[model samples]
Structures are given as structure tokens and as C-alpha cells.
Target chain A: MVDPTESPATGSSIRHEDHGDDLRTVRLAGRLDMLGMEPIALKFTSLTASHAQQVLVDLREVSFLASIGIRSIVSSARALESKGGRMALLVAPGSTVEATLTSTGISEVIPIHTEEAEALAGLGAAG
Target chain B: MAALTPADELHIQPDPETLRTASLWLAERCRQRSVPQELIDRLDLCLNEVLANLIDHAGPGVLEIPVELVLDPGDRRGGTPLSLRVRDGGAPFDPTAAPSPTAPTVLAETGIGGLGLVMVRRFCDEMHYRRVNDFNELTLLLAWPQETPDR
Candidate 1:
């Protein structure tokens, strides 16, 4: 498990948890806006896309989301897809984060799960 | 009970860094006016998108002028009507008229371009844009179901 400190300016934080068997989970919290994306973007990419490993981004604690943050997630997810890896997002059901992702139609490209078991199951099936 | 009551207004520079300030100010004003939390969240989201676009695409000329934000609350009726108006002296861009992008089925083909405007349109009930006296004035209007509890 890799724990990174939170950004004071944007109140965003990211941490990585290894579930063994080459599966990792990146838990993101706080706003995912223009400023919020700044602190965790590099770390998020390094943990998920750079290694080409299965990743489940947990966004249940995220209170706000914007298109810029969505762009970052899509960019990283695309990178992972290119490298033979898969990524899914875990968002709270009926949340603004979920609504935001749904509005962008990102669920078609990247699976968004409200349950962790479902998200992990989907990622596991991809391997 | 005028058609629209102007509750508050905020003036911000067209700077990316100042978007948060505008968002917080809007949220606080919404709360003070007993607006529902869900409506406040929607307003905050669209405000960020709109202000960010002004800073990014409106050019350096926008930096010289202040972006004006007004919160207009409608008469409490079937639902609470909330209208946010943003005015800036930048390039005349009408987000309301911008063509919405087709839904993407693949990650590689999905471009984040124009998605912000898509979000703004989705979150708000009505979007109106007009160029008046060399200023681009965009208004995002939304309302919540009356059953929603004020927070």
C-alpha cells in the first residue's frame, strides 16, 4: 500500500492499495476540478497507467468533479488500455461524481461501478 | 415576488486560479438563501465550467476586465428557480449555440474537448447567451423539485 499526502490547496488525496495478483486500487478523495487534479494527477498516473496494471479508482469520497479531471482520468485510462491493462471507476451511487461521469458518457468506455465487488470483478474478468 | 430577485453578485477576474473563489462564493450565497444542497452543487459545477472557459478561451483581453456573476432566485413555487448570470468583456462566444459532441464508445476516440459545455448544458435547465455592448453575457438557470429539503 502506498499512501500519499493530501493537497492543502485543493483538498485532494490519492493512495494505492495492492490486492495482490497484479491488481491495484487507487482511492481518490476530495474535489476533482482544475485545482484538485493538480496534486494527484502525476501520482495517479504513475500508480495506474505507468505500470500497465489493473486499477480500480475509488471515487466515493469525491465531492466535486469537473471536465478537466475527467480528462485526466480518460487520458490515464487510455494509456492503461494501450498497454494491455484495464481500469474501472468506483463511484458512489447517485453522486455528483457519478452523474458527471454519466453525463460525459464515459461509462461506455470506462466501466463505473457503484459496488467495489462489482468493480473488482469486472477488472478481474478483463485479465 | 418579482419575476426574479437578484440575491447577490460576485465580480472575479478571468483567471483560472480564481475559479475556486467564485465557486465558493456562489455556494455560500446559495446556502444563505436557503437553496437546496443539490441545487447548490449543480450551480457550483456549472460555475466552474463557465468561468474556466472564459479564462481559457476568452483570451488575454478578458484578463483586463472583471467577470461578473449574479445570483437570481425565482419566486418559490413548484420548484425553487435559481439563475446564475456571468458577464465578461471577452471574445463573443455563445456556449448555448455550440454544437454538442456525439457520445464516445471508445476511450481512444473520446476527446475531452467541448465536454465542459456539455456538462454545463446537462446540469442547467436553460442556458442563454447574448452579446451586449461588446460583453458576452451567459446565464445558466436551474431549479430543484420543491420536495427537496433546504440545507
Candidate 2:
């Protein structure tokens, strides 16, 4: 379910999805540029880094992504991994978000799945 | 690098606050020209990275100077049809000369630094930097993917 609290200024929104058994999904919508990141950056970091063990960041709805947004996800994923947790991304196969992730070689470090079930399954594996 | 008339130029101070304004201006210009959506996205990404670098690293004194942006839809004859030229009084920093960071193989090795330049390189077809009349000018070019003729 989508969260009601959306950031209108930057047109970015972040919501949490609990799938039971320590699995959760953070759905991000709107552009992930400097403005887009402001409203969701802190919440995204807190949810993925401090709380969830196996988190899936669904970026299917993210229209635009800048390096700043990528930085947020990478750093949070690193933090989550340090705490014995794992983070994966769900990106539309041929979307701009996917292109950016792959171009930066983020797909190599963090598993990116086009399908939600596959993403969750990948997160379930031992890191 | 053709000079942009006053009508085609956007001027904004080097404040992070103006980033959105700059982006929207570029988007609006591209939409008016009917530039392809993919090219527009590429322009927006590269523009942000270039501006962010100027705002964060171009030193405090440079903030007083306004950054200038000019979008040029070059001849559609195929070789780099679209280009955006960004002019600022910031110190000379050539993004094309900057080394792209190696992609991290693991989260432990990942760092946020230099990723912006990396994206700038990947998205832009060509990057040209020049110090023009004391202003650091960067021209980022993007080309439409060639459509294969019926085989």
C-alpha cells in the first residue's frame, strides 16, 4: 500500500512495506534528484539502515535518479549490510533508474531485480 | 559553441536552492523544442551533476557569480545533435578530465564520491570544457541513438 505522507515540493515519496519474517520493502516514487531526495533521504536511511534486515527498495516508480540519490541508497545499503542485513533494489528493466544503476556499476555490488518475487528471494539468500 | 541570445539563456546564482529552478527551466525549454524524453532525462542528470559540483566545490567566492545555461539543439544530421553549455565563474574544473571512479564490487568498497562525474560521463555523448574569458564553460552533448534501417 502507498503511504499518504508524500513530499509535494520535490515530488518524492517513501513508504514501507512489511512482508513478514523480517522482510520489508521501501517503495520510492517521483524523481530522486537533489530536491526529490530531501523529503525521503532521512526516512529511507533510517528504515533501511537501522530497522530492516532484508530490505527491498522498489524504484519502479522513480522517474529520475541523480548521483545524490544513488549515494543515499549505497550508503544505507552499506550500513544495513554492516549490521548483518541485506538490501536489494527492484527497478524496471529498461527504465532510466535501471540505466543509471547499471552505468554506475551499482548492479554489481547490490542485487537489482526487475520482479518483486525475485528481488525478495535474492534478499533471502545468505550474503 | 554558439552564443545564446538573452532569450535562450537562464541565469541563476550558484546556490543549491536554485538547482530545481535550473532543472525546470531546462525541462521546459526541451519540451518546447520537442526534444526526446530520453535526451531530456540525460540532460537533466548531467546538468545536476555539473551544477552540484560547482556549488559544492567551486569555493565560496564563486557563489557570487551567476551560472549560465544554454541549450543548443545542434544540426540533426546525427553527430551530437543536442548540447547544453553551462557557463560559470567558478574555478576551472574539467569533468571530462576527471577520472571516473571504479565501480565497487562490494558494498564495503562503495563510496559516494565521484559518482556524479561518472554519471555525467555515461550519460553525455561528449563533454567539452574550456576556460572562456575567465568563465569555466562546459558543454555536454547527447545524441539520438541511431535507428537501424529495415534490413
Candidate 3:
């Protein structure tokens, strides 16, 4: 059976693919805001508690990032960090996530990846 | 000399979905009164700002504390003005006195926080506050465009 926590929105396959070795990948799209973000946060919370290495959030498909969405990402990052892990993001070129980060000064705090492979490679947990 | 609607004093601490439903109702009320879309949009953004701020700063209560929204169609803008005060009992800091942020360089995150007040300022004329007793009295003032003389 497919684990329910791994899937995001229905009809669209928003999968958090397990890369094993404590690294995971998730894809996002459309507008990510307060309404569509709680579940994503819950999933990250669940995974990060058990695995204490790192989680890669892929915003390559996400168009916009709101304040609420940023809150969730940061909250999850702190949760993992407490357990000796970290969070990085894979951002698409010219996406709003970059502006949101830089504007909020998270580009200096929240690590960014231009490509998914690069993020996994950076974690050195590449599978 | 007109009386305020009964909703003038209604206070509800609602979750996201219920809060959204209530917001739709509020929008319909504004639309019925011909409030401009721009003003309505601002009101909606104001709701998001206060609610998100409350959640961020006002949790861990063991039991869910009521996130209060107090209505005071209390004749602020003559008879047509409805007033809303969304208060967060969290950390007790006044956003009114909080420093401003217009560009990226002006912001510094103590950690994971910066954008809420930014969006809030973009949407409202002013955020008023007074610390009364122990709770934060955050008053977000929004005037309906229909109520404006030249709007």
C-alpha cells in the first residue's frame, strides 16, 4: 500500500520520494500557501523526527511562496536541526521562491539548490 | 445616528477553514454594500496577517486558545465603518512600534520570521496597538472604499 503521508495533493502526484540514507525529496507546484501547506509540514515533521540527517524541499515546480509557507519550512527545518539534521531547497530558475528567500533574508539562512542532483550531492547522502 | 449590525460585537476564534468561510461571508457583506475590490482585498490580507501572526506567536497552550477577532462596527467611519480588532495574546509585542521593511536589505531575521508584517503593511493603512493588562490589543483599521467620499 502506498503510504498516505508520502503523497501531497491528489490528481497531482506530489511525491516525497525517499532517497534512503536519511535523505528525502519532495516536489511542489501551484500556489503554496496556508491552505495547501499544513499537510506538507506534517509530513516533514513525521519524517524528520525519525531520520536525523537532512530533507530536501524541491520548489522547482512551486511558483510562489507566501509568508505562511515560509513559516512551515522554517519550523520543519528547526525541528530537524534539533535532531542534528538540516533542510535545503531545490528551486527552479526565476521562481518566486528565490525572491521570497532573498527578500526575507533566507537565502543567507535557508540553503538553496539550483538542481535536485546538486542538493542530494551537497548533502553527501546521495543515493 | 444609525445602529450597528448585530455582527458588530461578534467575536470568533476560528481555524483556517472556518475563518475562511467567515471571511467569505464578510466579503459578501462588503460586496453587497459595494465595497471596492481593492479594499476587500486589503481586508482579506489583513485577516491572513493577524491570524498567521497569532498562530506563530500564540501557541503551545496545551488546549487550543481562542484566537480572537472582535468586531466593533462601532461607528469609527461614521455609520458605515466596521472595526475589527484581531488580538494575539502571544509574545506581547506591538507591530505598530515594530521597525519597517521596504526592501531586502532592511530586513534581518532573528530566525525564520520577517514576511508577515511586510504583507500586513502592504494591505492596511495602519496597525494600532495598546498593551492592556496582559493581552495584546492589535487593532487593524480598514475603511470600506464605498464609505470614502471620492472612492
Report iRMS values in order. 1.1, 1.1, 5.2
Clashing pairs in 2: none
DockQ, in order, for the candidates? 0.77, 0.77, 0.14
Clashes, model 3: 0
lDDT values, one for every candidate: 0.85, 0.84, 0.62
True contacts kept of each: 0.82, 0.82, 0.18
TM-score of chain B of 1: 0.90
In angstroms, how far off is B4's CA in candidate 3? 29
Model 3 agreement with the true structure over A1-127: per-residue lDDT tens digits: 1244423442122456676667777666544556556556666566544557777877777644667777767677776677787788888775446755665666666688898777888875532
Top candidate on lDDT is 1
| Cα-based lDDT at residue A32, candidate 3 | 52
User: Which stretch of 10 consecutive residues in model 3 chain A shows the poorest summed lDDT?
Assistant: A4-13
Give Cα distance to truth, residue B8, candidate 1, Å: 0.8
Candidate 2 per-residue lDDT over residues A28-120, each given as its tens digit: 999888778887898888888995489999999999888889999999999998888999899998898999999999999998999998888
Model 2 lDDT at residue A100: 97
Window of ten residues with lowest summed lDDT in model 2 chain B? B1-10
